[model samples]
Target chain A: MLLIEMFVFLGTIAFAISGSLLAIQKRLDIFGVLLLGLTTALAGGVIRDLMIGNIPPTNLAEPQYFLVSLLASLSTIIFFERIKKFNHSIAFFDAIGLGVFTAVGANAVLSFEYSQPFLIITMGLVTGIGGGVLRDVFVQEIPQVFRKEVYGMASIAGSVALIISYDFVSPIISLYICLTVTFTIRMLALKWKW
Target chain B: MLLIEMFVFLGTIAFAISGSLLAIQKRLDIFGVLLLGLTTALAGGVIRDLMIGNIPPTNLAEPQYFLVSLLASLSTIIFFERIKKFNHSIAFFDAIGLGVFTAVGANAVLSFEYSQPFLIITMGLVTGIGGGVLRDVFVQEIPQVFRKEVYGMASIAGSVALIISYDFVSPIISLYICLTVTFTIRMLALKWKW
Candidate 1:
């Protein structure tokens, strides 16, 4: 559980930074930057919770989520030049975040006692990529998941791995394996321009 | 209830047409057109339901909503020239749809036993403009509600009227008044470019 929470935290910060950078590029005001950052980090979970009938969403219920995203966004804006120079580092962290989020998302569905592989995988993919899709849309661009590389595909692959391995291995082990596979796929896609 | 349903239907079709027209202008493929149309027609309700903890979203559960949006989108694509020629007619319907949706959204929140005027009004405005926001975002532009002439403000006006009048009039009568006020404001905005 602690490991999962850590993953969620890391993912939140990574996604928030990505959103802030995009918002800055789009020349949005500070409020828009923060708003987009929060949306990109939390909207996916909110959407997932809503689909599963969870009210108010965990993001809304917990201020930490919002604070973390806000801080990350502010940091990105403050260290714009350094961050921009470390583009590869950002992409690497983003891949890890994607993997962790996919695993966490799948695990969330499992806790709901939904055993259907399709549903689990779908939920996981949404949880992983949904925020990015929204962030891209907010900037008035086609979602990168739909247009470029293997972003959504990598998340789906990770989700599939997590769901399929749930019965064969311990949940924690399954999560680690899922994260490894997803991260690898995303990194490879970025490197190879696939 | 019957009258509310009729308004919802009208709003759905009108929003769907607007979505399809925008998609066509963006040169989206057929699938993209349909997807945007459905998103524009139903995403607001979905967002509202999620915030209120309604599961699965009535929009997803009801096939009629999907079908109406799909048919509307198809018609727009097929009769592009004719629809383009009837721009005024489209705007007229769109205004009516906006009014009805604003009323319906406010009423939905009221049913949830939430008496907070601010929350009710915000939800109402969201329910009215959320779909259009999503549509605009999908096409890579600032939301019309944020940029255009009195779009979201008109919805807010309608929402405020609905909430304030709830004590003085029957819900039905309140809805009618809300609709008329919203429609008038939107049309006047259009006419005067407010």
Candidate 2:
């Protein structure tokens, strides 16, 4: 549980930074940037929870996640120039975040006892990519998942792996396998421009 | 209940036409146009249902709504040039849809037994404009509610009216009041370019 929490926290910060960077690039006002950053970091989970009948959502009920995202957005704004120079590092963190989120999303749906593989995969992909999709849409661009690289595909693969292995392996081990597969595929896509 | 269902059906078709028009203007592929049209017609209700913990959403469960949206989108495509000529008429219908959706959204939340006025109003505004917001975002534009006319303001006013009158009048009567107020405000905004 501690490890999963850590993964979620790390993913939140990375997603926040990515959202803030995009907002800054779009030259949105401060409020817009913050709103986009927060949306990118938290809206995915909120959407997922809402779809599964979780009212109010844990993101709203708990403040730590919100604060973490806010802090990351602020830091990105403060160090925009320096951060831009570290694009590769940012991408690396983003890949890790994507991997973790895909696993987390799959695990979440499994707990709901949804036996349909297609639904599980859809939820997993939505959890992994929904935030980025919302952020891009806010800035008036086609979602990157639809137009660029293999982002959503990688998440889908990880979700499938997690679903397939969940019954046979320890949950922790299954998560690690899902994370590794997603991270590798995403990183490779980034490198090769797939 | 029948009257309310009629309002919802009309709103769905109007919203779908608005979405399809915008999608055509954007030169999206047929699939994109259909997706945006369906999303604009249904997403607001979906968002509302999700927030109130209505899982899967009635929009998804009810096939009539989906078919109505699809029919609207197809008609918009087939009569693109003719439809474009009737921009003013379209705007009027859109305003009516907004009004009906606002009332329906407020009424939905009222059943949730939420005591907070702000939450009810927020839900009402969301239900009224959420579909338009999602449509604009998908097409990579700033939400009309954020920039154009007094769209959100009209919804907010209607929501406030509905909340205040619910205790004093029958739900059906309150809905009519809300609809009239929202429609008047929105039409005035269009006329005055507010």
Candidate 3:
């Protein structure tokens, strides 16, 4: 398996766990929680693929991705109390998921050979925030991206950093740069009054 | 305005009203109801557009859609009792909204030059059911589309009919044929044992 593919798989698992935890917090039924997790894990990438005219959708094409999401959901369910007690851990993990997914989304768009400036930025934002948007909407809340958290700005920063470093940096370096930019922006947003 | 544009506008209004009515039924707060109504009215098309890479999002580009949604939401809040007494009427209106939006969405994609195939069919289904999916997810109900109802199938049939007729008939004729197919399928699904 390619390195990038593995990263995407990790991102999917983290995203799914984030969603599962959110649903569990809401006291949703087990089935509902799983559905939420699966949807959050796959929905952003699926929508991105469909929009860019990628056929078959990534989730349907990859069983491993689905398995990861399922396992994450199950784990959350099995460890609800333990997970609940580690709230900061969950938040940091979710942030990492968001950062990695943002970078991966930007990479996917660039790989597709789409160079439109706004389109690339938008892809990064959508990919990073789409799952959370769906999660909030499912829970009947305003999407987190729309609020003034600088959350989506992390996605923008990551995408821009990836694009700028494309010429000089190695792929691994680019990934870290993107992740660092996103993680720092997100953490700072949470730390400082934004 | 172009005839199709007018229909799209009308469809938005109709969907907005239906969303507002559902919110009222749920006894949500006024802000919550309006939020539900506006999001439901706009979400499907927004998702469709984003998937197709239509940027800036139509809802964002046109303020009137928001205005119409607001008016519809406010009207429902003011006239809840009257609307409640006419549940059947509201359902019929909602059906019309569905029919109109399905046709509009199919036509828009066809105009974008996507050829007939599974993609076009999927687009129609997305457009038809997107808002309702958002609505159900918010209400925490199992989505009507996934259930045994013929909801998405109706839109798929309508889209296919539209595509088939576009080669031989004027746009208006195609619209009529599409609407007829969609409305018939939906109403039958509601009225009959199937």
Candidate 4:
């Protein structure tokens, strides 16, 4: 659980950076940048929680994640030019966020005692892609995920793996399997131009 | 209660028709039209249900709304040419939906016994706009509600009206007040080019 928590924060940072950079690119104000960053980092989990009837969504109720994403967004703004000198791409952080969120979301459904395969997979997929979809929507673009089949396919594969191995493997091990599968697929798609 | 039920159906039809027409204008295929229609008609209520922790959301669990939306979409497709003559505009149906959904959604929050004003207002707003937002996103457009300030403000005002009047008035009357406020504001905004 601690390991999962650690990865969640890392994923949060990745998503915040990805979202804030895009906001800057779009010439949004500081408030817009912060709003986009938070949405990218936390909207998925908030939506997942709502579906499971978890009110006062964790991202809102728990201050730590909020603070972490806020700091990440602020850093991105402060270091915008510095980061651009290195040519930091959005895809890299997005991939990491996607993979980790996929596994974490699947695990959450299990914790809530929802074992129906469709629900578990949908939860995982939604958790992984929901934030990005929302970010794209807010930015008024067709979601790249929908356009890029491989992106969604990667998350789906990971979610499916998590569900299959959940009964046999330890929770931590299952999470790793899910993460590895999705990250590998996404990276391959990016590299091979799939 | 039956009156609420009747209006819900009417709103569902209105949203479905509006969404399907947009899809047609976008030159989407039949499936796209149907998908957008369903999304517009039901996604708001589904989101609202999920927020309340209502599993297997009423829209999904109860077959009636789904059927109505489906029929509405089918009719729009069949009567496409005839509808063009009537010069029907999306704004009209959208306004009706905003009013009814805002009222219905606010009432749902009360039924859940959660009295938090922010949450209740949000539930109402989301229920009124969620589906339209989703529809616009799928078409790769900026959400009309976000761009047109009056659209969202109308929903917000209605939600506020519902919240203020809920405690003092009967449930049905409160619903009417919410509906009237939202509908009138939306219509006036359209008429006056606000």
Candidate 5:
């Protein structure tokens, strides 16, 4: 459980870093860049929370997300050239982030007893892809989800796998299986240009 | 009713134009600009609809909103400099657009029989301010809602007026009153530098 929480938090932090770096690359002012990172990292979860009738948004309730993203942004700016050169590495971590996000989101919704499988799947996908969609929109680029790449598809696949495996395997085992499947597919897609 | 719908369309078109023009100003590709405008104009309504369990969203069901926004964006691009010169006038129109969006959003939620008045007012504010938020976020700017010109405050005021006036006036009159009140306040705010 602690490991799961750690990976989830790391996934969130990674997404935040990715978003903040995108902002910095665009030459946005510090406030603008931080806002971009904050919103990009939190928008998906915020939207999900709002849809599930959680008001005022979790980002406001827990301010650590914003603080962490700001720190990440500052660090990226300090190491700009090195960070830019590590694009593939970032994408690989992004894949892990996506897997973790989808798992957490699906598990969250299920814990709330949202019964519709379709809704669960949709939530999983939204939670996984929402941040990046927001980041792309902020960067004034067409979202990758709408273009090509199996970005959200990996998350959905992972989510479905988690749900199916939850009944048959231990929760930890199911999580590992889902993450492995998502990471493999996503990495392969990037490697072979699938 | 047709006239009311016409105003609703006008607000959507105006916001869409603003979004598209921003995208173009930022030198985004055409598809990117259009997607930004579409999402900017409709993200609030889409989120609202999805929250209320309306899948696929109203904008998807009826393409008129998207079409109007597309045309508006194209028109703005064609007349960029001319429009830019009329910044104040455009701001006035933008305020009106915000008012109309607030009214329509409140009407939609009230129609759904949501019992919480505060929630309805909050929804109205979200609907009105959501487009601009999306626009700013896409442009990688801090959302005006978080800081600046009392945007969401105006929407909240308008929603309160609308809900209160519903008891004393015809629904149409109530909408007109709300819109007028919101637009007037916004215009004054702009003029007085409030």
Candidate 6:
């Protein structure tokens, strides 16, 4: 459980940095930079929580999540030139973030006992991609997930894998399966430009 | 109250038809057309309900809303050529939708006792524009509300009106004031091309 939480936090920071980097690239103001970063880091979980009737979503209610993302975004904005040199590492961490979000989302729905197979998978996919979609839409660009190589597909696959393994394995094991599957696929997509 | 519900229904139809029209213009499939129409008609309320902990939003739980949007979308798709002739009528109804949604959104926040001044106004603005933003994002367009003249501003003004009048007037009357303010501003913006 602790291990999973650790990765999720790392994912949050990675997403925040990525969001801020994109905002800077777009030449948004300081406020815009911060807003975009927070949105990308938190929007997915917030949307998922809302759909499941989790009011005052954890992302918003927990100051720790907000603080972590804020620091991540600020650092990225301040040191963008240096961070730009670590493009490969950023992408690698982003892939991990994608994997963790997908698995965690699926688990959330399952834990809620919604009893709908589709809801589990749908929530999983949305939780993985929602932030990026909002980020792109804010910038008035087509969502890269819709147009980019294998992104949504990778998330979908990971969610599907989780659903399939969930009945057979421990919940934690299922999460690992999902995270591994998603990260592997996303990384492969990036490696060969799939 | 019945009168307000009637106008809200009218607004729902208008938003649905407008969403479908844009979908058809973009040459999307029948499924895309239907999805966009439903999205424009209901997403705002869903988002609002989620924020206030209204589980299984009325927009989704109540069949009437879905039926209205579905019928509106279907009719728009079938008689698009004829509908094109009523451009003026559609805009008029859409303006009504914008007004009612803004007022209702503010009233909802107030009724729920959210207690934050900004929450009331923010919910109102988001409800008025959320559907349109989702619709535009689905089609990869910059949200019309963000770029268009005075669309979001009108909603903001109406919400402010509601908050100001709530202390002195009946809730229904506050809604009326909000509706009138939003509608008048939207209409003026359209007329003067602001």
Any residue pairs clashing in model 2, and if so which?
Answer: A140-B140
lDDT of 1 by residue, B108-177 (tens): 8888888788888888888888899888887887888888768878888998888788899999999888
| Model 3: pairs clashing at backbone N, Cα or C within 3 Å | A51-B51
Q: What ordering of candidates by DockQ runs from best to worst?
A: 2, 1, 4, 6, 3, 5
What count of clashes does model 1 give? Answer: 1
C-alpha DockQ for predicted model 2 = 0.19
**After superposition, candidate 4 runs with Cα above 4 Å error:** A1-38, A50-129, A137-194, B85-89
At residue B61, candidate 2 shows an lDDT of 94
lDDT of 6 by residue, A54-107 (tens): 765677545677779889999998899999899999999889989999999988
In order of TM-score, best first, we have 4, 1, 2, 6, 3, 5
Per-residue CA lDDT of model 4 for B57-161, tens digit only, reads 899999999999999999999998887566436577778889999999887888888776666666787799889889988888766664565786788799889
Candidate 5 C-alpha lDDT tens digits along B1-194: 58889988888887887787777777776655666677678777876676565544566446678678878887877888898888787787788888898888777787787747787787788778887887777666788778866777788889899989998999888888778777788888888888
- Per model, the share of native interface contacts recovered reads 0.33, 0.29, 0.06, 0.24, 0.06, 0.24
Interface quality of candidate 3 as DockQ: 0.08
Comparing to the true complex, what docking class would candidate 1 get? incorrect
**Model 1 bad stretches (over 4 Å):** A1-43, A53-125, A135-140, A145-194
Model 6 residue B60 lDDT score: 90
Q: Residues A1-119, candidate 3, lDDT per residue (tens digit)?
A: 97666767777887888888888777776666876787788778776787676754556444667778989899989988888898777667767777888887777787798977677
| Candidate 1 lDDT score at position A184 | 96
Worst 10 residues of 6 chain B by lDDT: B141-150
Candidate 6 overall Cα lDDT vs. reference?
Answer: 0.86
Screening candidate 6 with a backbone cut-off below 3 angstroms (N, C-alpha, C), the clashing residue pairs are none
**Where's the lowest-lDDT run of ten residues in candidate 3 chain A?**
A55-64
The Cα RMSD across the true interface for model 6 is 5.1
TM accuracy, model 4: 0.64
